[model samples]
Target chain A: MKIADVETPALLIDLDRAEANMKRAQDYADAHDLPLRPHIKTHRLPRFAKAQITLGARGITCQKLGEAEVMADAGIADILVTYNILGTAKLDRLADLHARIRIAVVADNAPVIEGYQARFDDPDHPLGVMVECDTGAGRNGVQTPEEALVLARMIDAAPGLRFLGLMTYPPRDDRVGARLAGMKEAIEADGIAVREISSGGSPGLYSAHETAGITEYRPGTYIYSDRMQVAAGLGTLEDCALSVLATVVSRPTAERAVLDAGSKALAADLSALPGHGHVMGHPDAVLTGLSEEHAVVDISACKDFPAIGEKVRIVPNHACVVTNLFDSARMIRGSGVEETVRIAARGCSQ
Target chain B: MKIADVETPALLIDLDRAEANMKRAQDYADAHDLPLRPHIKTHRLPRFAKAQITLGARGITCQKLGEAEVMADAGIADILVTYNILGTAKLDRLADLHARIRIAVVADNAPVIEGYQARFDDPDHPLGVMVECDTGAGRNGVQTPEEALVLARMIDAAPGLRFLGLMTYPPRDDRVGARLAGMKEAIEADGIAVREISSGGSPGLYSAHETAGITEYRPGTYIYSDRMQVAAGLGTLEDCALSVLATVVSRPTAERAVLDAGSKALAADLSALPGHGHVMGHPDAVLTGLSEEHAVVDISACKDFPAIGEKVRIVPNHACVVTNLFDSARMIRGSGVEETVRIAARGCSQ
Candidate 1:
């Protein structure tokens, strides 16, 4: 099928640009001597993860066990689940996956450790564990270096777990790096060697090297730079590879047009940037509003508005959430349609 | 499977409450002399649509061709697609479904009419078409009464198309009803009978009776009232039948607990009621933040914060969007899992 012949409200990925993006990030990580473990939570496509691995990615990072299972099913062996696995059902899945591949998990609290201890206390084959540090996002992780040491001690003391190192989601801020370094020092003072310190954030990818004692870097959004990345000064709009191919279904007025893509397609992730997304080729147009199935566009300032049934490409505000909204995405290489690839981890939100 | 063992971050629907909510709306529409065309976009389940039919709905409403196709496959013979059918691919599907079911479509532009004329100009099998009016939502539809007349004339002029009447998404605000009524009067003055004036919106479902000449009413979210509906004064929290069963994945501190449900599960639809969602039992707790995989909750104000791994039910800000996030939803009867129903229309965003 031709790219133009694809249906409206569909996900379109520029394969060439995506490959280039992968190479760019890999090159940066190589130059800084950092092993790039790209997070699969962004694309959720094992094909892209394999492409990244082919381009020299160390492994893959998944935010959920279900995502890791899908990635492993795709024959990608090494996986890191960067969230706490608490419940028995999830722990059983984690243990099963651990037996199959090199899997590592992160924890920030005692109950999480206790759950892990109860399920994964087999001394024969130990599970790698990392302590999550609350650098600044304030969403997850321990508050202080002392708390990190406390969790590290518990992981190292566990019979079936090996204390791998420290990990933080957005190791963007310098303070986060300094805090990780201090925690590592405190952890080593207690006679436990920190083998790996992982930090991840696309907006702060370049800053990953500046963070002291970080050995591995993970970046999800770098594969598909979004409106947020561009606004965060990570890269230009030209670096964005993923775009939603939507048709102007209705022109309510001269100043307004409605695209088939809405929150269900483009997602409701409002970046720090103003509108919902950037309408490619129409610099003056802004996605003023979004209903479930329609994106209300204000095209009054455009030099020329698109006609009804005209297809328009949109770079969504947050590519990660948008990628998860679709079941599959059309792979396009310079206007030529490749094949449609199922997002193997699209609804792996467990 | 038992409801407690179903899994965390799952979509749960109270079947009893849903039946009650459906009956409540059906009773109101019957009393008001309006044919209730319950939109299938909320539950997107054939079971619920059939239940609504059993409870006295005239037909069902769908927003996309894909959804309508699913409903048709499930023996729903009468379906109204409330979206403009453009492009050959979608039009082919629409025509195919129209051949099998009593299907009606809406249009507000010439290109849309031209597409319909090209395919369905057969006088033998006329297609029911409605002129969508931009009453007040300003999303899609013709701007004025004259524009509605123009579309109505075009529909009436087409050999294969029958002009049904008018339709608006949100029948809220007195001005919208006045405008719609005026448009109906003007269109009828042009010698074309406006057989039906369809108006929809759960927030304005009760007030739909106040509209001077609306012949049909559609409400989707009434089957599952959400936090947004409550804040809009549509109903109370008790009226909400759908809730996300999310587990506390992590408690980084006594004040903060991370839920397994995030934007992927609960959605990013902000409510006027404040916070991401209403934590059912923890009235004082606030869902302060959400990422792709986790919802950061603030439980400082709560007298008793939930422990790690504890499950909590949450009424999402928008129930319709949340329904689209999952592949299936668990149906519960008084806290016991009755069955798991597949969201047959999920990813039917095309």
Candidate 2:
């Protein structure tokens, strides 16, 4: 079935383009001799994970255990949960997943370490725990390398946990190289051999090799560059494989048109882009704003406004958040929808 | 099955509270002697649609055909789709739905009316078409009352379509009542009986009742007041029945604690709220920013910081968009989750 035959506001994945994106990232990893753990949180489809693994990805990186569980179900043996897992319910689920698959999770707190130890105490599966160091992003992780070492030692001494390495999601600043290098030396001073220093960010993907002690890389959104990627000068619009296929539901004037895909489908993320989203074909058109089910596109910037009922593709600002909005995306290949891949890990933010 | 028993970053709906919300709206409609056509787009749950119908709703209002289809499956007879039905594909689906149930769709353009006429020409089930007039939102609908009448005449001339009445989604400004009255007179001047002048909004629900000519009211978000609603002075935070249950994933500093619910869960809509989202318990703690998987809450305004692994509920700025992010929301009774209700119409943007 072609895209015309499918529903509007549907998640459309250009498979050939997607595969090319997967291979390009893999080729980059191969050229640099770096271990590539493609973040599954972007596509969240097991099929894409398998394709990445087939193209020689070292493993997969999931943001949540729920996402890892879906990947594991699809026979993904090695998984790295880049986020901290706390609470008995989550830790127990993590232990069960660890027992079945080669799994590792990052941590920065003693209570989280103690929780993991208490759950996987007897004949522990040697759950690999990475000390999450705050490189610059102020969301999570320890502030300094000394603080990371403290957490690392606590994990090493824990009954069921194994101190695997140091991990940090650094900010997209120029100081990332210095921060990583400084954190590495501090960990080494504590006599802890950092086996896998997993550092990742699409903006910092090129700088991965420069960071002296980095062993593996996990970048999710790079697989499908979005409006954010283009704005950050990471990738172009053509490199974006995922687009929201929406119809011009209303043409208020020659300058304005409203599409069916709104914040619900496109997501209201303005993180790495100028507005809510970008109209794919109409480069000059600006998605000025979005209501719940209506995307207000200002076509005054374009030479001509699209006619009402015209189907337009939109590249959302952030692809990862948009992926989580849908249960399945229509996989388009050579102008036809080949299959429907379920976004199985969608809404699994447990 | 307490809320504590359920994992964080989950969607919770207090059924008793939701029922109360439903009843209050129904009571208001009865007291004011107005037809309550509760918009189901907010919840997008068939059970809630059925309950609304059972609890004295005149009918149901849907923003899309997908949502209308979901409500139709639950035997919701009278359904008004408050959106322009564009393209042949959507019209065909609309025709099928019209045949199955009493369906009314709003359209603003001649081409949209032509498309509907061509599709439903057989006359087995004539489509009820309302001329959508732009009161002031500037999103969709005809700009002037004359434009509204022209569209109404076009629909009246069409063989397969039944010109029902005038419809307008007024802006959030204070001039809604006068606009509705003017549109009513314009349609009445053409010797056409305006059976329904449907006008309503969660923010303007009270004002809609004050409007002289409106026959029916359609308000969706009132059933679950969001941060937007609260900030708009429509309802209080205590009136919000739905919330994103998130865990403190990271506490990087005394000033910041990151919740697992990010843009994907809480939504990045700062519509009527001061910031991204509002932390429920810590009203002073503002959700300053959000990544795809982490919400950064600034607790510097509060005396205490949220500890890592602690659970916190977040009221998203826009509840409608938040519903679209998840497939199912856990229904809670008192403090515990009773069952998960599928947001069946999620991602059904077609």
Candidate 3:
């Protein structure tokens, strides 16, 4: 189906472009001799995860157990949940999942590792635990190399938990490579051989390849480069494969136009991005504000603004969270709708 | 279930409090003799929609056709979609839904109405068409009384379209009364009667009683007051029954703690609120930043912040969009987890 045939405010994914994006990342990993574990949080569609694996991805990384469960149900055996599974409710589910699949989880605290140890003791399947070292994003993970070793030692000594390796998400700094090398040295001094040093970031994808001691990479939004990615000089508009197809519901003035898609369609993630989102084809128009059901587009910068009822594609600021906003996306191939892929794991954030 | 037994990053709804909130809105509408058409965009849960109708809501008002379709499937016959339905795909779907149930849709542009008229030239059911007049939101609606009259005349002349009345969502200004009066005078000049003049806003719920021409009031977030409603001084902390139950995953420093819920769960809507979301019971703490799976809380103001692994409830800035982010929300009656209500309509925008 053509763009006009499809519903407005719908998600459109170009499969050809998506597969090409998948191959580009895979080829880069192959050339670097690094294991590519594409994060499924970007698409949250099992089909996309399968496509990544089919394109030679080693495995997949899930941020939550709920997301991992969806991938696991689709017969993805090797999964690494790059998050701290906190409570018994989640730990129990993780242990059950571990019995059927090769499951690994990351932790920065001893209590979290101890909780995993207690649940996996004398279990049917052993659990792989990775020590999360903060190279300095300041979200989760151990702060220093000394703190990383302390958590690594605790995991190595704990029953039912096998110490896999070190994992870190370094801050946007120039010394990330040095910090990763230091953390790796600290772990080796504790008599723990680091097999998989998972490092990630779309902005630091190239730097992560150059960084020493990083064996695996997990980057989610590399497939669909967004406004933030473009602004950071990471990717171009041509790299953006997914966009929100919205119609101009109201043209309040020549300067302002309202689209049917709002915060619910295009999420409110302005993390490292310059603006809310980029209006495709209208490079000058800025999505200045958004309500629940209306997006305020300032077209004063553009020589010709779109009239009311005209359709426009929007490249959201952040593609990962934007994927969670829609239930399904229309897969487009050669300017027509091919297949509608269900975002099966869209809101499985338990 | 006790608070400790519940899962982390789950949506919690207090049934007792929800019922009370529903009753309060119904009682206010009854006392004022106004038709309470509760907007279902807030919860998007059929159970809550049914509860609203049972508690004396005249009908439900949905913002999208996808939402209206869900309500129709749940046996909600009387429904009003307060959105301009554009395109043949959406218009065809709207006609199909109108045939299946008692439905009405509002329009502000001639092209949208023309599309609706072309698709349903001889509709199976009379399509209730409300002329959307812009009160002051500057979103989707006609700007002046002349525009409203022109659209109203067009609706009257169009086949298979029943002219319902006027609908407008005013700004935060308390001048909704004067704006509705202007639309009323214009409609009377054209020798047309408005059967239903619907005026809506949770902030303007009280002031709507002072408006003369408004026969129906549609307020979506009255049942669950979010950070926006609380910041608007429309509701208190006690009135907010729905919250994102998240666990503290990391204590990065004495000043910052990262929770499991982030933009994915809490949503990125910073609409008219001081911060991303309000942490329940921690008035001083503010959600400063959000990554995909991490909600960075700046609890530096709190003398004794909760330790890592502790659970905290977050009343998101925008409750409507937050509801759209979850697959299902946990229903809690009194002090126990009653059941899980499926958010079936979520992500059904296509």
Docking class of 1: high
Tens-digit lDDT string for candidate 1 (B199-268): 9989998888888888998899999989888888877998899999988887888789899999999999
Question: What TM-score does model 2 score on chain A?
Answer: 0.96
Stretches of candidate 1 exceeding 4 Å from the true structure: none
Whole-model alpha-carbon lDDT for candidate 2: 0.82
Candidate 1 lDDT, A159-226, residue by residue in tens: 99999999888635658777888888999999999999999989988777877788998899999889
- TM-scores, in order shown? 0.99, 0.96, 0.95
- Interface RMSD, candidates in the order listed: 0.9, 1.4, 1.7
Q: Taking the tens digit of each residue's C-alpha lDDT, what string does model 3 give over A1-350?
A: 79767777888887777787788888888888888888988889888888889888888999999999999999998999999888788888998898888989999887788789888875335689998877777778888888888888887887678888888877778777788778778989778877788988777775567787688999888887777777777768888888999989887566888898888888877665656788888989988877777898888889887787888899998888888887789998867898888888987776
Local accuracy of candidate 2 as per-residue lDDT tens digits, A1-350: 87876777889988877888888888888898999888988898888898889999889999888899988988999999988888877887987898788999988777778787787765446788898888888878888777777887888777677888888887887687677677667877888777778889886776678777778998888888888877877768888999999888888777889898887788777764566777876888888888778998888888876688778888898888888877789988867898887788887877
Whole-model lDDT per candidate: 0.90, 0.82, 0.83
CA lDDT for candidate 3:
0.83
Pairs clashing in candidate 2?
B1-B336, B2-B336, B3-B335, B3-B336, B9-B245
Alpha-carbon deviation at B179 in model 2, angstroms: 3.0
Error of 3 at A61 (Å): 1.1
Q: Which of 1 and 3 is ahead in TM-score? A: 1
